[model samples]
Target: MSAYRPEFEAALRLFARASEAMKARGFPAPILVGGGAVELYSNSAVTTGDFDIVTPRQEEFEGELKQLGFTKPVGLGHTPLGWVHPELRLGFEIVSATVLNGMADRDRLVLIDLGEDGEVAIISVEDMIADRMGQYASGTAPEMLEQARQLFILHGDADLDYMDRRIRHESGGDYGVADLKA
Candidate 1:
């Protein structure tokens, strides 16, 4: 069995439950994105307490989570609405769409069966790396450089060419995998 961190496992469970609830109520499932997707793609090598998801219908998605016992917690800073599980500290950052730092629609989503009518949708590994690299390039987050480097070293199969193109395009030729490795 593959090992997952406790925080990720909890978030996956919540995502599964939320997906089922939304489907029953006629809502489309949200695409799992951001750092949580990194954790999932990296097989928990990278972990976060929060799950970031993007969907066309944010209000409906959030409503479903609220109906499923997730509450909007305060002091999370600028996230529109930060929902948390009643018992666990797991947080959800539901957003309108995939933020286009780069690597848009480059790969397919991988679904993980969580058992019982719950399936989790994860962003592609390429896109996940793009997300991290985007953060690194923007100078908003210096630590994302290390995260991108770790992902590059840890996931050998990740497409270096694609990542290089994305980093250059999004950063206006400022950064690349070479920078991460150096």
Candidate 2:
């Protein structure tokens, strides 16, 4: 199976540029999260319609994104500023924190180049799955449960114990260790 998707490529390219620009300005690279992170970690087994980004440095990061041609904000006045790529027609939502399966800290981030000009910061596969599971439990994005299951089936190496803890925590025991195994 080929993990090739034009949307994924374009999003990564934009993210890499934004990351590099932020670093050039002495700001930390934001961690890629939500569906976009799932798409990358799944090798494109799943794709996202929008990019969900997390960083404490919202102002600085938005400035970098603006430099990369993401000028028009698209959301209805939200904290997580939304933008549409003028050329690619892709969308980006930048937030300061991860509401689902939040990382312990930025130290958990890993940088991957994906053969691109600059590397992108991403959460671990375990964290990404837990994030999906959190979404599932919330009843807001039940589709994430399927995304989580697909990612687990595709990767086959995520930390089960860690994933279980996150699922149980986020689901408040409504989902348990058995749920993770399933």
Candidate 3:
């Protein structure tokens, strides 16, 4: 009954399986971040070709991925350390050992229940917007600003005070929560 794209659904299912496997092996579940989080929060208004995750235990996580049939590309042409599932054609990359390089508030992390698929943890909307703002402030891409605006507009109930502090921290005060409205 969910209106999410097939890719998104598949990705979540895969993430759930991986999380369960990791838990069974005594490793903490990986946190979903980057474009995957953006796609999820955007309600498929945006799409990412790959999924990015954060986990302190990279090697163990990769092992779990391999057990899940995600294999590393043979050559250096692809994303280093990224794994690709041949049949699903989905790529997964572990972007960082810590969530938002440890800048994000642990209390703000959102846990989404997938019913039988288990649960997935994602960065809060405030942190995601702040992350985009930080990317824009760094002169990396103007699109990040637009994405932040879209998220702000869509998530009207977002905590502005938290966003303000997070944006200031992420952008080094180059951008603020007010800027997201602009």
Candidate 4:
């Protein structure tokens, strides 16, 4: 698994352009939010084939594509990787308050250097665990639980206590260390 890989250096250029576009236009952070954001680090989710850019005040542009709880403008020039730039599109997803809040306080997230190629500034694993909980909170997917368990088993760092607290808070019960693999 090429854990947490996304289109590299070009995305930074695009981000700068997008950020500048937003700033110059008096928009907010113009943050990146969605699977692309998460895949910047974790191997859990991969190339979602789309980019999710969020802004406070949005004006629809032509060629906007809306799906997966997101809206993107239509006919943005494509990258070599064939992914679209959302800023060029009029489509903007109205993201959750939590996501917007997280983007505001970007320092809370973790940054792992993917290389000179590009660094991975991903949401912290703790937040990743918490955020993903919404999908499986209803006991719908056993595989989802397994993925969480695997994440803890392999990359849990030394903060078992912290992981446990998050698990309890989101999962609604303690699986206990016995349930976790050594």
- TM per model? 0.84, 0.86, 0.95, 0.50
As for lDDT, the candidate ahead, 2 or 4, is: 2
**Best model per TM-score:** 3
Candidate 1 per-residue C-alpha lDDT over 1-182 given as tens digits, one digit per residue, 9 for 90 to 100: 15887766877888888877777778767788877877776678877878888877788888878877888866647354688887778789875465453346525567779887488777766666767877777889988877777777777887788777767776778877688677
Better of 3 and 4 by lDDT: 3
User: Looking at candidate 4, what is the lDDT of residue 142?
Assistant: 55
Q: RMSD to native for every prediction?
A: 2.6, 2.9, 1.3, 7.7
> How far out, in Å, is residue 134 in model 3?
0.5
Local accuracy of candidate 2 as per-residue lDDT tens digits, 69-114: 8866536653345777777766788755553434344565778875
Q: Compose the digit string of candidate 4's lDDT tens values, residues 110-149.
A: 5444343333334555545544443356567555455455
RMSD of model 3 against the true structure: 1.3
Candidates arranged by lDDT, highest first: 3, 1, 2, 4
Q: What's the CA error at residue 95 for candidate 1, in Å?
A: 3.0
> What is the clash count for each candidate, in the order shown?
0, 0, 0, 9
- Predictions in order: lDDT: 0.75, 0.74, 0.86, 0.44
lDDT of 1: 0.75
Stretches of candidate 1 off by over 4 Å are 24-26, 75-80, 99-103
RMSD of 1: 2.6
Candidate 3 residue lDDT tens string, 38-145: 888999888887889999988988888888888998765787768888776778999999988898998889988887878778889999999999999999788999
Worst 10 residues of 1 by lDDT: 98-107
Which candidate model has the greater TM-score, 1 or 3? 3
